[model samples]
Target chain A: MLSKKAQYAFRALAHLVEHYDSGPVLIAEIAKKKRIPLKFLESILLELKKNNILESKKGKGGGYFLKKDPSQTYIATVIRIVDGPISLLPCVSLYFYQRCKNCNEKHCGLHDIMKSVRDATLNILEKRTLKDLI
Target chain B: MLSKKAQYAFRALAHLVEHYDSGPVLIAEIAKKKRIPLKFLESILLELKKNNILESKKGKGGGYFLKKDPSQTYIATVIRIVDGPISLLPCVSLYFYQRCKNCNEKHCGLHDIMKSVRDATLNILEKRTLKDLI
Candidate 1:
């Protein structure tokens, strides 16, 4: 399941994608339009900015905008940045792999199945970008 | 991400699948072998039993076993019982569908993408059963 944080991030990103060339969008406007709580959305956008997915301007007409073209922003990238991992098991994760205690991945049935699941999920997430969302 | 509860459930179920038709296996044995905490595994097994995926016997030689054949238990069934929904978005879930607050599902791009994701995930999870785990 997508975390509340990741869901909000997607909602906020979709809004930004819609306003891509129109310039910065106010945080408050996104909050009101997307129904995300203001404080939570602020943190989500800041995290996106820190990860270089977004940038902002200050003063008059100041607001947030995508740092890259929506076509270049893969759904998988955003999900990983906000949600930590795509795999259900840490052992099968491509970017967040970790050895399960007292378990051998080479001989684990769960590992093999989860790896397939991760691959299947990534097949869709990696191919679709924010541009595709629009 | 899979909840710790769901992960433990899979590990326990996989252990049961290995010992299917042999006899009821001790919970303590599964806990030690799977590296699951004993207390946690107890609750998980109880939940699976409640969902009719597992059955337990009491007294000497007592333990838990699969209620149905390993091949009859779909991975998606266990996951949905243990972890709620497979889809990232509530609106896209087939069995656990819920309307997204303040949003129209028909015109939502995230909804469409998530529906695709749900289908891809279900494609793998629904076809594979406990028999395939071993």
Candidate 2:
């Protein structure tokens, strides 16, 4: 399951994608429109800015905007930043791989099955971007 | 991520699947072999038994065995029993469906992508049975 943080991240970014050319949108507006808590949405957008996925302006008319095109910002990247691995099992994860202590990878059926699950999920997430949501 | 309870449940059932037709196996043996804590394994197996995936023999040589053939037990069933829904988002879930509070299903791209994810996971997990693990 996607964590609440990841879900909020998607909502916030999608809002930015929707208003890309309308100048920086305020945090309060995104919070109100997305139904995300104001404090939490502020933190999420700040993190996205720190990662270069979003950029912020200061002073009058200041707010946040996508630093990269929405199509270039993959959902998989955001999920990874906020939720760790896309894989259900650490052993099968590409970005966050960890060997299972209890089983041999050569023979473990669950590992094989989970790898396929991860692959299927990653395939869609990597292909789709925030633009797709907008 | 799979919950710890679901992981323990899978370990316990896979142990049972391996020992099927060889008589009931002790909980301690499975716990020690699978590196799962004894108390946790006990609860997990009991849940599986209560769901009819397993049965206890009682008395001398008593332990647990698959109540139905391992081939008849699906991983998706166990996951659903423990994890609620296979979908990443509640709106995409079939058995545990709920409308998203923040978005319209007709226009929400995240909803569409997650449906594909849920379908892909369900296809694999429903097709592969406990017998496949053994």
Model 1 clashing residue pairs (backbone): none
Model 2: CA > 4 A from native: none
- Per-residue C-alpha lDDT of model 1 across residues A3-73, encoded as one tens digit per residue: 88998999899999999999999999999998999999999999999999999998999999999999999
- In candidate 2, what are the lDDT values of residues A1-134, reduced to their tens digit? 78889899999888898898989999999999889999988988898888889999999899999998888999899988887888888889999998888778898888889988888888888998888986
Stretches of model 1 off by over 4 angstroms after superposition: none
Predicted structure 1: lDDT: 0.89
What's the C-alpha lDDT at position B8 in model 1? 85
Candidate 2 — which pairs collide?
Answer: none
TM-score of each: 0.94, 0.96
Task: Give the alpha carbon lDDT tens digit for every residue of B35-81 in model 2.
Answer: 99999888888888888788998888999888998899998998888
DockQ by candidate, in order:
0.69, 0.79
